[model samples]
Structures are given as C-alpha cells and as structure tokens.
Target: MDKAEKDQQDDSQDKMVLESVSGRRLSYDMKTPFYGDCRDVDDFKKLNRVGEGTYGVVYRVNDTKTGRICALKRIRMEGETDGLPLSSLREIMILKRMRNRNIVNVTDVAVGPQLESIFLVMEYCEQDMGTLMDAVPTPYTPSEVKCLMLQLLEGLNYCHKNYIIHRDLKLSNLLLTREGILKIGKLKFPDAQHQTHGIDLIVLFAADFGLARTLSFPSKPMTPKVVTLWYRAPELLYGDAHYTTAVDMWSVGCIFGELMKHKPLLPGNTEQKEIELIVNLIGSPSDAIWPGYSKLPFAKTLNIPKQEYVRVYMQSKPESFFHHTENAPLLSSFNNLKLEFPRATEHTLSLLSGLLTYNPKARLNVKQALRHPYFIESPRPLDPSLLPTYPEIRNQVSEKEKNRRAHDEERKKRLAHEGNDSIFSADHYKKRRKD
Candidate 1:
C-alpha cells in the first residue's frame, strides 16, 4: 500500500514540473520569434574562403534557394565559452541597422546545428581594395583615387552621423562590386547616367564592422590598439584613449597617400617605429600644435629631435616678422610634404595635409573633406562606373602565396650571386697554386 501511494505522488510532481516548463517556453516564444525564423547554415553552399580575420572567416557562398551569390562570414568562436563575442554582436547589430549604398548590406544571419556556429550573410563584392591594390600592375590615377575616397568618406559620414565609428578603416575593409547601380531603400538608379564609356559603374562598399562602436557623450576610454599600425593616427600611437572620429580621418589620409604612392604611407614594424615614421613624414607633434600632446602617456618616452628656428612673416595691417620653430627635424622646413609626393597637385596636397593634421581637433571632418577643392579641380573625381575592373586576385592566388613566392625569388637570386663569387675565388686559388 505504501509503495503504490509513493509512486502516484511522484507521477503527480513530474506532471506539474512539465506544465511549468511549457508555460515559460510559451512566454519566451511570444516575446521574440527571432530564433524561430533563423535559417540553417547548411542552406547556403560554400564556394570558397575569401578572407580570414581576428573575428571571423569570410567565404563566398551561393544561396541554394535563390541561386544568388553571397558573402558568408562565420563568426570565430575559438576558446569562447561565454557566448557570441561582443565584437560580433556589435557588428551584427550595427550592420542590421545601417542601410547605405556605400556600406555592405547584411541580408540575413544563418546558424549551424551548434550554438557557436553563426554566420552573417552579406551581399557579395567582386573585389576588396587591398587585394586589388596589390594585384594591379599600376596604381590608381588621381581621378580614380578621388572617386574611391569620395565613396569611402560618404560611408564614414553615414556611420559617424549615426553615432557609430569604424575603428578599423583599412584598404582591406573596403569592398567593391562590379555593379554600377546605386540602390537606396526603395529607389533604384539603374539608368544610363550612372554609366561611363559603356562600362557599368563600380560600387565601393565599407565592409567588416567588427571593431566598430557607437560613440557616447563625454568620451570613454577605449583600446588604442584598434586600427592597423600603418593607418593608425598619431594620437593613438601616443596612447590617447579618449579618441574620436579624428582617428578615422587619419586613416583616410594614410589611404590617400598609399593610393598616390602605390605603397603604405607609414608601414612600420613596431609601434615605436610607427610613431617615428609618422614624425618623419608629418613632422614631430608638440604642445603648440597638438593641445595636451605633452601629457599623453607615450609622449614623454619619445625622443623627438630638435628642429631649427626659421623666420616666419605674417601679413597684417602692419607686416610682422618672427622666428617660428620648424617641427620637422628630418625634413627641410620648406619641403615638409612636397618632397614626398612631388607629383601631387597643390589642392591634393592641401587635402592630404588637412586629413593628416597633427591635432585631432583641427583634422578635417568627412563633410569638410568631401567639399575640398581637390574634388572640384580640373581632374575631377571620375565616376564610380568609370573605375577600371581587375581580376579577383583572391580567387587566383592568396596574398600569403604571393609574398612567399617573392621571398623565394629574392633568396634564389641572392644565393646565385654568392655561388658565382665562390667559383671565382676557387679559380684564383688554383691559379696561385699552379704558379
């Protein structure tokens, strides 16, 4: 009798627990149906790996349902036991909210059977600016560079306006599509006006928002090691934590210089080397030029060389003259930047200087940069459609392979020269012995 009663009580308790669990599940389902609508990663067919970064591995995939090509980015979850990385979450949240022609569009998010296997489905771009720059035989002309810069600035302007900052703005993060049309929310411009010389217009897109963040009032401290070393701003190098969009403007300046020169403007191996490069290129920063510069954490450790004083004339109601100390220790005061880019036009140089200004406060904003005289000059910005197309280098050969080949070729040439020198020395020794 006691055993039968105990078994019946246990059954009643189990039934109550099941009902409670069902009620909670129903409540969550009603609140948000996001998980319910998510598609499986298996739905898209993997084409090839396009890129791999700190946060994700990007692949060119085809949508089996629509037969449309898309870029699939799988979020990297290695050693991540907590959940989705905050950077990935921020990227997904930002991309989903932003809709601009110059910015890459995220179509959907696909998940795998496991909780960690998450992927972002985005519009496929034919080429990234970094690979194209490295693969192309020639550098982009001034007009073409202007066109690309304009699109990049437009995208950054949009992001900044929305209180977002793309901490990492490098050539690699920029995407370009073969299509020329500019499609807004519901409006599409697929007319002849968008074409140039019978070629469809190319569209530039700002992609990979992994390190992006929303700006807050009364600036907060952030990690200074964000932008790539080559494009990092001087302030960031000096350990400025309370940075702003000015950091992005500095990167744009670096990109501008790279486009004109066909190489990195400040390609340094280490942070100290990077700072030295910046100082050499743009002149040393001082408290006079950059307010609070001397107070920066890294400023005191820098060994900035002293420069000579030059006579500066000021034109006013009554002309005034004074000895102004030149800050460029390595460069002549008269040829600070002209010596670097001898072919750059006056307006172009001015724009570059404005962007790469030492002071964050004095740096050109996106709006100001877009309206610079360089864009309005004789060699105006070529239309995006007119930009030349290049073969997808990523498909042909990876960057790593190209670098390895170059290194191997150099080593072979070096070894061959050494071998010839050794042979000559051996012949001389034999002749001496015969004599």
Candidate 2:
C-alpha cells in the first residue's frame, strides 16, 4: 500500500509542474518579435534618458557596433494590438528619404526583445535651443543672429523646395551641437499631413518632422491644429485649412523675432489671446490687407473684436512717441515699429515688418526673406565660425528652476513699472513653486 501510493503522488506532482512550465512559455511567446532589418536593440548601450514627448522617449546611447554616441528614441506603442504606429512609420520613411547636413541623420533602427519595442538611432546633438536659451548667460550678437537665421532659412528653403511643410517650428524643437550646429528634433508627422529643415545661434538645421505635412499641388485642405500657439501662423489660428507654405513663413518670422529679442515675441496663453496679441502688434486684418480675411472659418464663427491700430500703439508707447518737434522729414516719417522694438535697426525692422505682416499672402517667403535688405545691410551676418562662443549649457535645469527664473523676471518687470511689491507677487511666487 505505501509504495503504490507514494509513486502515484509523485507522478501527479510532476504532471502539474510540467503544465505550469508550459503555460509560462506560451504566455511569453505571445509577445511580438522584431522581424525588421535591425533585430537587436542590445547592439547599443543606453546612457541616459535625454528627452520624453508625446511620440517617444529619447535616450542618449553609445552604439557598440559603430563606436558612436547617438540618440535612441523608443517609440511608445503600448496600446497598439496591431502593428507599428503609423506616425513612427512615416517618420522612418521620411528620414530614410532625407539626406542633408542641415537635417538630423537617422543612423539605424533597432528593436527590443520583442517587436513591442522600436528605437530610432539618430546622430546626437548636445542640447536643444529651449534648454540653451533658459541656461545661456549671454545674448547672440546681431551678426551671429544673421548667420543662424541664414542657416535656418537655407534648411527650410531646401525642405519647401522639396515640397515638405514643417507644421511645427518652435524654440524647443530646434537643437544645437557643442560646435554650434543646429539640428531639428521631435519630427512627429501628422496623419496624412506631411513636412523641413533648420536652428539657433549655433549653425541651425531643421529637425523634427512629426507634425510635418507634404505640400500638395492644387492645394488640398489640411488641419489647422498644427504649430505651437506662439509660433503658429495667423491663417492657422484663423482656421484656414487651405493654408499654404505661408504658415511656415510666419513661424520663421516668430523665430527671427525671438532671436532678436532673446525671448518669445508672442507668448499667448489662448487662441483668443494669440489673435488679439497679433492684431495689437500688426493691427486688425482686413480684405484690403489680407484679401480674403473675412472668408476664414474663425471669421464666420468667432466674435473678433475690432482692434484699433493707433490705440494699441498708444497703449504700448506715448502718442507723442511718433511725433517729432524737430521735423526732419525722415525722422517724422518713422512709423510705430521703431517705438516697439527700440533696439532694432531700420533694415531689421523692415524685414520684421514684412515677415510679421497681417496678410499671409504678403508675408516674406524664404527666398524673399533671404534677399531682404537686413541681411545685406552694413553689419552683415558673420561666418558661423566667427560667431561668439560660449560655455556649454549648465547641467539641465529642472522645471522648478525654469518657473522660478520666469517669476523672477516678471517680478523685476513689475518692480520697474511700479517701484513697489505688486499685490500678486507673493501669490505668483507660490503658484510658480507649486508648478
């Protein structure tokens, strides 16, 4: 009785163990495996997490195979029960087709243990302009600004000529290297939307094509919900889906202004505020100026307050600012822009005025902006090598540090205006700390 009972118990236990092992193996095998060109992500040694955004998580990695430092962006595809994300597929296709010094180069593609993970291997740039701008202790000289602007325009012009439109262009998306070369970042192409090329004081290259849309002929209507609010074109803001390359031109203009001012030209918090800020600066749009301004979707639906140009000018500066007692005809003829951007040269102002015009049709295209008198004027843009060099950006600042810096600047501006502690200063500081 004892020998037969013991043998039967041992057999049952062995069968149960085998069943558990088989179940574990089946669950593991259910995960998708990479069948693409490069199958092993282990080929690269990940150094650190450099960036994270809507599309993917970026890591600074060393490619063991090539002995090179590169950025590896791991596309977030958790929800997909199907295949690779279409956005990632478009980015891969676009980058593979692009070969330019001004564009960030995709070196290779790698997959993790399962097809669940995908990574894009790109040539690494030291840091992006947003990080640099917040950390750099100095401002760019006019000549240096020109060189950077020229490079950006060159990259963008090349992209446009190739029929790609960069729907999103902002300070944060523009990256720069230690040697002062710019490369665009975060290229997350829009669905059915297509994309450029450009950068900052460092030689600029157009990065990110994620939100980029291909420019179609006989121009089809595309979504207006592209480009960051501050850098977005008026046509986009006004809900003009049939917008053209002029949308990009407006962003270039904003970037140009940012370079000159060393801060965002229009940091509107909302769509209404953005349009209001624009109208306040350039005056309201009209058929006389914009030709088809009234036909926009926003025009038909939104209650756009009629803005008076002279009133806005007076709000920012004294009415007498434009009036001159010494009536030298040229001095009296000077417009309101001189008062707004006191540091800008006449030629620079001329270019800004053209680029920042109310009418998209009237805005300066890349070639037109490149040919503007500002670039050809007396203080020509110096060669990139000759641009002033600065130390590398400080170890990346935390969000708290950025907020504190912003609040400190606001406090200083308020103190300058009122010569006392403003009522909301304490509350504002508290809010910033919380943020």
Q: Give the per-residue lDDT digits (tens) of candidate 1, residues 1-435.
A: 699997886675444323322221222112112122234577899989987765567899999988999988876555556444333343344465568888777776666656466677888888877777887869888888888888888888887787766777877777888863222111111122221221121111123553565676677677687788999998888899899988988999998889888888889999888877777766777887678999999898967655432212211111111122122211112235567899887667767877888788877777777766678777888898988876777778767899998986676566555665664454444465479
- For model 2, the superposed segments whose C-alpha errors exceed 4 Å read 1-39, 85-91, 189-207, 308-336, 388-435
Give model 2 RMSD, 1 decimal.
16.1
In candidate 1, stretches whose alpha carbon ends up further than 4 angstroms from where it belongs are 1-36, 85-91, 180-207, 307-335, 397-435
When summed lDDT is taken over every stretch of 10 residues in candidate 1, the lowest stretch is 181-190
Q: Give all candidate RMSDs, comma-separated.
A: 15.6, 16.1
Assess candidate 1 and give its lDDT: 0.66
What TM-score does each of the candidates earn?
0.72, 0.71
lDDT of each: 0.66, 0.65
The Cα error of candidate 2 at residue 151, in Å, is: 1.1
